[model samples]
Target: MEFSFSNSQKMIQKEVRRFAQEELAPQYSRWDREKQYPRELLRKMGSLGFIGTSVSQENGGLGESYITEGIICEEIARGDCSLPMATHVAGHLCAGLLEHGSQEVRDAFLAPLLAGEMIPAFCLTEPGSGTDAVAMQTSAEKKGAAYILNGEKSGITAIMDADVSLVFAKTDPAAGAKGVSCFVVPRNLPGVTMQGYEDLGCNAVVRGSLFLENVEIPASYLIGEEGTGFKMAMRGFDISRILLCLEAISPALVSLEETMAHVKKRVAFGRPLATFEGVSFPIVEHLSLLEAVRLLCYKALWLRDQGRSSSKEAGMVKWMAPRFATNAIRDCMLLHGHYGYTKEYPLEQRLRDVLAIEIADGTSQVSKLVVQREVMGREFLPYNYR
Candidate 1:
C-alpha cells in the first residue's frame, strides 16, 4: 500500500505544476471574467505532450500512466479549474478510445486526438439520464452496413468545439446494460445538429447538446463490439472520476492557501484575522479534509496504474473529494466576509467552479448508491426500486 509518488511521477508532477502556475494561473482571472477558453494554450499543451499523456507512444502519445494523467489534472486544476475541462478530460476521453477502439478506428481518431489536432467528447449523459446511464434514450440501430442514430444528448462538455464525439447509445433496448454501444460520431456528419447551453460554472469552456436525427455512419464507427458500450463507458468514468476529484480538490487547496495568506495580513479590531479562532479553526478543518481527500484521489489513481479494480475506491473518493473540496471553498468564501461575495477576488468564482463537481461525473446520491451496491451487493437495490 504505497502512497507516495515515484521519482518519475514526482518529475511529471513538477513539470505539470510549473506549466500550470506559469502558463495558466496568470490568465485565469481574465479568462474567467471574459468567459473565454484559450485555444492557443490548448495547442501549447498538445505541443508539450500534456494533452495525450496516456496514449501509447506508438500512437503518437507520450504513453504516460493514468497516475501521471491524474497529476496533470490536479496541477492544472490547482492553478485554474477550467484548464482540465479544456484539455484534461478531453485527454481522458481520447485515452478511453485508444484503450477500447479498434485498430482502424484508432488510426483515424487516436492519432489526431493525441496530436491535439482534434478534440473529443464522451456523450453518455442525456436529458433523461445521468447517474443511471442505462436510461439513456439515444438509439443506434444497425442498418445494413451502417448505423442510424437518433436521440439527443445534453450537458455534454466540450461538444461545441470538439471535432468528434465518443457517443454512447442503446443498440439493444431489451438487453439493458448489455444493450449499450459506443460509436465514433464526427460532428460534420449528415443529420447531426448541435444546440449550445450554459452552466453556472466553468464558463470558460463550451457546453452544448448534440441532436442525432437519423445520423448515419458506417458500422466501423462502433468503438467496441455491440452490447459492450456500457462497460466501456463505465470504465471511462472510473478514470474520469479521479480526474474530476483532483480538479475539485485543487481549487479548494488554492482557496485555502489564499485565505490563509489573506488572514495573515488583513487586520480586524487591531489584529490580524488569523488571530481569531473563528477564522483559524475553519482553516485547520479545511486543511485536514483537503489532505485526506488528496490521499484518496492519489490512491485511486495509483490503483488504476497498477491495473487493480478501483470501483469501490473510486466511488468512495467521488463522494468524498468533491464534497470536502466544496465545503472547504465555501468556508473560505465565508472567511472573506463581504469580499467573498464580490467578484473582485477569485473566491466567488472558485466557489461557483467547485460547486459543479457536486453534479459532474456522479452526483452525491448516485455515488452513495455505487458504494452501497459494492458493499451490500446488487440485492441491496431491488430490480424495481426506482
Candidate 2:
C-alpha cells in the first residue's frame, strides 16, 4: 500500500499540527484537571472545519477522505486525545447520518453540525447493556406519527453539550436484533434530560446519562428503515474504528518521541540511558509495531474509500493499535523514571487517554472474536448462538 501523503495531505497535516500546537496543546492539561470541555476551543475548531472533516462540502465541511480525516485526527490527538475525540464524535456521527439518514433528517442536522453549531452524541449503550447491546432496555413505541421514547441511555460521550443524539432502542422488544431502531432526538424535547458522568479520562468529552421519559419525536427522525439500526451502528463503528486507531497512533508516536529525546539526555551510571539496550530495544519494538498498525489503519480507510469490505482489517487494527499503543506508553513511562508517575509529565495522561481506545468501539477481546468469526466462519464462532 502507498503510504505517501500527497502535497494536499501534507498541507492538511501541517494545518492540523499548527492548530493543535497553538490552540489545543496548551490548555489540554488544564481542561483534564478541571474536568471541563472548552466551549471556546470547540468553536475555534469549528471555524477551521476541523469539526466536520468527512462531511460533504455542501454540508459546510471540507469533505476530506478517510485518510485525510485520519491524518487530522492523529495531529490533533498528538497534542491531546480529548479535543480530537470531541471533533471525531461530531464528524463521525454527522457523516454517518449523511450516508444513512433520510434527506429531511440530514437537512435538519448535518449543516448545523458541520458549522460546529451543534454537538451530536451517539447513545446506544444502556445501564444494563454494555457489550451486549442487543439487550438494551430502552424502548420506543410508535404513537400516530410519533415515536414515544421511554428508557435510559448511559455512557454517552458528549450528551451534555449535544444539541442532538443518534439514539438506538428497541422498536419491538421481543424481536431481538430485528427490533432495533435508530432515531435523531433533539435535546430540548420534554422529558429528555442529561445527567453528567465522571470517568477516569477523556473528561473533556462531557459524558452523561440520557433519560428519555415518554419523549416524543416525529417518525421523520428515524435514521433509516426500522430494524436496521443495529447494522447501521456496526457500520458506523467499522468506519470509526479506523479513525480511533489514528487517534491512538498520535499519543503512541508522542510517547515514543518524547522518551527518545528524554533517554538521550538522561544520564545514569556515567552514560546516557539511551545507551542501555533494555530501554532502547523496547522503543524500537514499539516503533515497529506502531508503524505496522498505522499502515493497517490507513489501509482500512483506503478500502472503505474504494467501497470494499473492511471488517477484517478494521477489527484487526481496532484490537492491535490501542493494545500496542498503551503498552508503548507504559514502557515509555518506565523509561521516564520517577517523573513519569506525576502529572507534570504527559505520560500518565497519555496512558489514561490511549487506554480508553481498547474499551471504545470494541474491546480488545471482542475485536479478536470478530476477526475469528470473519476467518473461521460462524460455525466455529463461540458466541454464534448468542
Candidate 3:
C-alpha cells in the first residue's frame, strides 16, 4: 500500500499547519479561558476554504477529497483541538445534508454556513437515546405543506450560537430507524428554546440542549428522501468518526512536541530531563502509539477516497485515538511537574478537551462495537440476540 502523501497533499498540509500554528495555536487557551467560540476568526478561516471542505466546487467550496479533508482536520486540530468539533465535525454533517438538500435549503442555509456567516448544529442524540439512536423519541409530524418538529435535543454543540440545526426526528414512529428523517430547522423558529451546559471542557463550543415545541419548517427543508436520514447520518459518521480521531490525535502529538521541548530545557537533579530514560521513554512510547493511530486515521480516509467502506478502520481509530491522546496529554502534564497543572499551561486544558472526544461522535464502547460487527460479522454482535 502507498504510504506517502502526494506533493499537493503535502503542500496543503504544510500551509494548513502554518496557518493553524500562527493563527489558531496562539489563541487556543484564550478561547478556553474566555469560553468564546471565536466566530470572527472562524469567518477568516471560512473565507480561506478551511471550513467548506465538504462543499462542492460548484458551491464555492474547495471540493477536496475525503483524505484531504482529513489532513485539514488534523492540521486545524494541532492548533486548537476544540475548534474542529464545530467546524469539521458538525460542519461536515450539515454540508452532507445540504449537498443533497433542495436548492431552496442549500441556497438559504448552506451558503451562509459555508461562508461561516452562521454556525450549524447537528441534532441526533436525544436525552433518552444516544448509542441506540433509533430509539429517539423526537418527532416531526407532517402538517399541510410543513413538518412540525417537537422534542428535546440534548448534548448539542454550539446550540446557543447556532443559526440552524440539522435535526433528526422520527416521522413515522413505528418504523424504527427508517422512521427517522432529517430537517434544517432555524434556531429562531417559534417554540424553540435552549439551555447551555457547563461542560468540563471545550467551553468555546457552548454545548447545550435544544427544546423544540411545535417548531414548524417547510417541507422543502427535508434533507433527502423522507426515511433515509438515519442512513445518511450513519454514512457521515463513517468518516466524521475518523476525522474526529485525527482531531484528537493531533493535539496529543502537539502536547508531546511541547513536552519534548520542555524536557530538553528543563533540568532535573542537575541534568536536563531529556537526559534520563525515565523522562524520555514515556514520550517515545506516546509518540510511537500516536503515530500508529495517526497512520490508521489516514488509511481510513484513503479508503473512503477509494469509495470503500471504512467502518472498521474508523471504529478502530475512534476508540484508540482519543484514549491514547488523553493518555499522552495527561503524561505530558505530569512530566511538566506543577507548571503543567497551573492555568498558565495549555496541558491542563488539553487534557480536558481531549477527554471529551472519548464521548463525542460516539462513545469508545460503541466504536469498538462497530469494529466487532464489521470484522466478526453482524450475527455475532452482542445486540443481535435481542
Name the best candidate (by lDDT). 3
Q: In model 1, what lDDT does residue 129 have?
A: 88
lDDT (CA) per prediction: 0.83, 0.85, 0.90
Residue-level lDDT of model 1, residues 1-386, one tens digit each, is: 66677899899889989988898888888887676878788878888788868877876778888888888888888778866865766788655765677788888888777667778877888999887889989999999999999999988887778789888899999888999999999999998888777777788877889999999999999977999988877787787887888898898999999999989999999999999998999999989988987887788777888889778777888888888988898898888888887888777777778788778778887777777888999787645332
Cα deviation of 73 in candidate 1 (Å)?
A: 0.6
**Of candidates 3 and 1, the better by TM-score:** 3
lDDT of 1: 0.83
| Tens digits of per-residue lDDT for model 2, 1-386 | 57699899999899989988888888878888888877777777778877768776766577788888888888999888866676787788545765567778777888777667778888988999877899999998998999999999998888888889988989988887888999999999999999997778888787889999999999989878999888888887887888998899888898899999999999999999999999899999999999998998988888887889888998999999999999999999999999988899988988888888889877888788778888989798776443
Off by over 4 Å in 1: 382-386
User: Could you tell me which 10 consecutive residues in candidate 1 have the lowest summed lDDT?
Assistant: 377-386
**By TM-score, who's the top model here?**
3
Candidate with the larger lDDT of 1 and 3: 3
What TM-score, computed on C-alpha atoms, does each candidate reach?
0.95, 0.96, 0.97
What TM value does model 1 have? 0.95
Backbone clash count for every predicted candidate, in the order shown: 0, 0, 0
